[model samples]
Target: MIKNFSKLALAAGVSAAIALPASALAEIRIGIAGPQTGPVAQYGDMQFSGARMAIERINAEGGVNGEMLEAVEVDDVCDPKQAVTVANRLVNEGVSFVVGHLCSSSTQPASDIYEDEGILMITPASTSPEITARGYELVFRTIGLDSMQGPVAANHLISLEPKRVAVIHDKQQYGEGIATSVRDTLEEADVNVVMFEGITAGDKDFSSLVTKLKQADVDYVYYGGYHPELGLILRQARQADLDATFMGPEGVGNKDINTIAGDAAEGLLVTLPPSFDEKEVNQALVKAFEEKGEDPSGPFVLTSYTAVQLIAEGIEQAGSTDPFEVAEALREGSFETPIGMVSYDEKGDMESFEFVVYEWHADGSKTAVN
Candidate 1:
C-alpha cells in the first residue's frame, strides 16, 4: 500500500509540472501599425519590410537583452478614424511600443490614443510638424518634418528660377499642410505663386484644373499630395498637351506614381530624405535588407530600421519593459541608427536630419539632384 501511494504522489507531481503555464516563452510584443490595405499600402509594405529585417537581425543576435522581439501588425487603412481603433487594440493587448500610422492625419489621431494609453510610438515616416508639436511625451519621429522639407523644395524651385510657379494640393492634412508650407516659404522668398488651389484626391479627371493652369501659363507646378492624385493630374495634363514641370514633396517618391501616370511621370522633381542606403552610414542595415530581398529605394526604409534600433536601445537604457521608463530613456537618449545618429528633443522630434532634392526619371528611378 505505501509503495502504491508513493508512486501515485510522484505521478501527480509530474502531471502538475507538465501543465504549468510557460509564460516565459512568450515573445515581447511590439505593435506595428500602418496602411496595410489601402492606396498607401506601399508605404506600409516598406515600413514592415524594414522592421522585419531589423527584428530578424536582432533576434539572430539574441534579441533585446535576451528577450525575443515579436512585432504585431495592425492595419489602420491609412485613415485617421481607423488609427484610433488600431491604437486601442494595441494598448489593450499590452503592447508597450509601436511603430507606425504613416499618414499625418492617421498618425495624429493614433498618437492621442498612444499618449492616453501610455504606449510609446515612434513614427518612421509621418512628417507633419504638428504631430510632435502636440507635446505628447509618448510620441516621437525619426524623420524631418514638413517644416523642413517645404523650404528645401522651395529653395530647389528658386534655383530653377521658373517664370511662374503654381502650388496645389489634394485637400488632405498632409497635402494641405505641405502646400501651405511650400506656398508660404516661396512667397517669403518673393517667388511668384501664379495659381494656388486644392483638389479632391482620387478624382478620376483633373482636366478642368489642368485647363485652368494652362490658361494661367504656369511654368512650374508644385503639388502637395501622394502619387495617386499627382499621377492622374500629370497624366491628364500631358494628355491636354500642357507643358509644365511637375514638382512635389516626398509624398510623390514611390514607383507606383510612374506606374499610374505612365510616361507623364517623367521628370518629377521632389524633395526627400537624402539617400541613406547609398551613404556609408547605412552600410550594415542596407546589406541586411538586401540579404532579405528587400529593396531600399524608399528613404523611410532606413528610418524604420533605425526606429526599431532606437526602441531596443531605449529598452536597454531603461532596464525595464515598462512603457513609461522606456519613453523616458528615449527622450533623453542618443543612439546611432542606420540613417544616422538619432536623438529626440523634448518635443520628440529628431535632433538630426536634412532634406535633399530628387528627380524621378522617366523610368521610375530617382536620382539626387546636385
Candidate 2:
C-alpha cells in the first residue's frame, strides 16, 4: 500500500511540472496604430512592416521571457478623433505597449488616453515638441523634435543665398509649429522672408500660391507640410515656369511625392534623419524588406523598428510586462538598434538624433547634401 501511494504522488508532481511552461508561454500583445488607410497610409504601412518583422525575429529567438510577442494593429488614419478611439480599443483589448499614431495631431490626443490607462506609447515619426512637453511619463518618441529640425532647415536656406524666401504651412499643429520655428530662426539670422502664409492641407490647386511666390520673386520656398500638398505645389510651380528651389521637412520625404510631381521632384530639398538604408547593420533588414516586396528606405522605417526593439529590450530588462516597470527600465538604459545607439533624455526624446538635408532626383532617389 505504501509503495502504490508513493507512485501516485510522484506521477501527480510530474503532471504539474509538465503544464507549467505551457501556461507561461501565452502571447503578449503589442499595439501598432497609425494611418493604414488614408493619405499617409505609406507611413503607417512602413510602421506595421517594421513592427511585424521585429516581432517575428524576437519570437523566433525565444521571444520576451519565453512568451511570444504579438502585434495588434489599429488604423487611426492620422485623425485625432480616430486616434482616441483606437487608444480606447487598445486599452480594452489589454495591450500594455503601443508604437504609433504617426502624426502629432493624432498622437497628442491619443497619448492622454494611454496615460490614463497606464499604457506605454512610443512614437516613431511624430516630431512636434509638444508631444514630449506634456510631461507624461508614459510617452516617448524615437525621432527628433521639430525644434531641432526647424533651425537646420533655416540655416540650410540661409546658406543658399536666396535673395528672398517664402514660407508656407498647412496650419495643422505639426506643420504650423515647424513652419513657425523655421520662420523665427530665419528672422533671427537676418534672412529676409518675403512671405509667410498658411494654406488648407487638402487643397488640390496651389496655382494662386505659386503665383504669389512668383510675384515675390522668391528664389527659395520653404514648405512645412506633407508630401501630397508639397508634390502638387512642385508640379504647379513647374507648370508656371517658376525656377525657385523647393524645400520642406521630413513630412515631404515620402517617395509618393515622386509619383505626384513626376520630374518636377528632381531638385526638391528635404530635411530628414540620417539614412538607415546605408547602415551596415541594416543590410539584412533591407534585404528582408525587399524579399517581401516592400521598400525599406522610408523616413520612418528604421525608427519604427527601433521602437519595437526598445520595447522588447525594456521588457527583458525589467523582467516583467508591467507597463510602469517597463517604462522605468527604458528610462534607465540605452538600446542598440539598426538606427545605431539610442538613448533618451528625461523628456523621452532621443539624445543623439540629427537631421540632415537631402536633394531628390528624377529617378525617385534622394542623396544627402554635403
Candidate 1, residues 1-370, lDDT tens digits: the string is 9999999999998887776534534467788888889998988888888877778888999989889888989999889889999999998888888988789999998999889888899999999999988779889888989888888999889899988899999899888898999999889989899888999887888999999999999989999999889999999999999999999988888898988899988888989998888987667777777877889868778788778888888988998888789989988878877787788889999887899888898688888899
lDDT of 2: 0.91
TM-score of each: 0.93, 0.93
Taking the tens digit of each residue's C-alpha lDDT, what string does model 2 give over 242-343? 989999999999789999999999989999989997888889889988898977888888888888889999999999998889889988898889988888
Q: Which stretches of candidate 1 lie over 4 Å from their true place?
A: 1-26
Candidate 2 structure, TM-score to reference = 0.93
Stretches off by above 4 angstroms in model 2 are: 1-25
Model 2, residue 263: what's the lDDT? 98
Error of 1 at 154 (Å): 0.6
**Residue 114 displacement (Å), model 2:** 0.3
